[model samples]
Target: MATYDWLFSTLGLEQWCGASGGSAPTSLSDLAAQSRGETGEQAVDIWELPFPSMDALNDACPAFPQSRELTLGLEEGFLDIKDTLSVVLDPITQPLSWALDAALYGILNTPWWIVIPLLLAITWAVSRSWGLLAFVAACILGLAFIDHYDYAMQTLAIIFVCAFICVLFGVPIGIGMSRSDTMQNATIPILDMLQTLPPFVYLIPLIFLFSVTEPKLYGIAIILYAIVPVIRLTNLGIRMVDKNVIEAADAFGMTDRQKLFGVQIPLALPNIMAGVNQTIMMSLAMVVIASLVSAPGLGVLVLRGIRNLELGVGLVAGLGIVLLAVILDRVTKASLARINATHKA
Candidate 1:
């Protein structure tokens, strides 16, 4: 006799139990074992903890649902809305795919010699530091020597696109937030959630929203994961701009737009730069994770290494990522330093 049979009989639930369509179990102690495909005849030890499975409850009464049913219901619910979400989201996000594809194509097809020299020149122009220029050159050259140059470039191309979009849209949002307390209140919670969420979680909704073959599948994930820092810092920077400076601009008959452009943004440049720096780093980090959804670059190599148990492959790809990160960090920081110096002077 099942342990719950007496209770069911006492409660006039025999009819309900008959309708449940579950097999009889000797006792609640057997629920976990039954769920695991084990025999349910074993006795429960007094010292052991008991976990009554939802299936066990269902066996006792038809009204009770099994755990699997709940999970299945959730899956069915998401599936019901999945098509609607894709229809609404696909057109709006298609351009992101185009930009990412273009970047990957341009970077991959360009010869190393042309790409390397152009990068060095851009670095030199931005930082005005020959030492930094050389370091950046060395890092890229090192990746090329290892035959990891293409992989590195793929990673960089994604970062270049995602980070640019992040700043383009994120800065305006930050500016809006900085100008209004209500907006700030509404935005802070979202930023907090995005910043704190696990990197992999960013991919889950995107995976369902877009096909895995699409570039925007991972592109969306990388952007969502990396964009938070720039927005938060941009807001902080603008709000931190000195009130006296703002008043000074006002006294000179500067309009709100002029004050923002001439006074506020200029003073806030350093913080904004810092945010860009962080956003770039975060982009790099997510690119690796995004590889799971078909993101190209060193991350693909890294993921391959992990999947195939190739220690050397993983290590080399990881080193390539490190080199890329250093090159990016140094370049951005040097640029930031130049901005700070110009402001101080």
Candidate 2:
């Protein structure tokens, strides 16, 4: 603020906005309308949006790629992405979608008597620990008792699906990066951009390319946002393996493939698992933001509570998310611990 004030006062740059010599009757209004994208009649004044200097931006990187595919993707689907996605991904997305739609429908239509125990039992069973089971159950029942079950389910659905996909996609990439310096260097910048970006920022360009209706819209956002840790950690894990062990494998006259699979990757499992844990946590965090674009979850409830000023609803739903996070974190950590311990012993 002080620097801006200094600049405004010292340079007399305020004249650009026309306080003394440039002020016009409808200058601000015209600027506002243009900013708002209002032509003859579109939107009202919205001057807060940033204006990209087209020539200057293009000058920096003159050979900008044409976005015809991007535009077509938005309009229909990019190179039959919908059909391709449907054929390749529908089997997985469909079931989860079914589960979510079923869960939501069940929550809104069915009695609390059914929802609470089901969420509790399922969470406990997955964690495979009595204490974690009880804790998760308590969290679920507490959320339900407070009437936050619907939002909780919405969040859970996204987390489950996105986390699964993240691990599925990330592990292979991590493995590849670990094996090749070229791959690692190539991928690091892309991952950096994904991980360092603000959670909400992921939604912007995505919004231009896809509407709220497509399941893949938020799904892609969730994966991209959560994928960084797994890939990095997987690479790190593999790289961090004992040189002695790798040499020992080499002494056996093993190939690089055998060494990686038999020694490096096994040793790296703990780090990879930790990465998966982080990925899941990140996926949960993104799901909440993704709800802004219609990715359902406990986030939707939080949003609802915010929009309607339903304090209790938001509080209970938020608590459900905390409970979910704890269960996931603990189970994943414990699993990794057991694997590491067994390896050591």
**After superposing candidate 1, which stretches have Cα over 4 Å from the reference?**
1-62, 65-71
Count of clashing residue pairs in every prediction: 0, 4
Error of 2 at 240 (Å): 0.6
Lowest lDDT sum, 10 consecutive residues, model 1, at 19-28
lDDT (Cα, tens digit) per residue for candidate 2, span 227-325: 899999999999999888888898999998888788888899889989999998998888778888887778877788899999987776777788888
Q: Candidates' lDDT values, in order?
A: 0.87, 0.71
lDDT of 1 by residue, 309-338 (tens): 999999999998998899899999999999
TM-scores of all candidate predictions against the true structure: 0.85, 0.67
Q: Candidate 1's error at 53, in angstroms? A: 10
Best by lDDT: 1
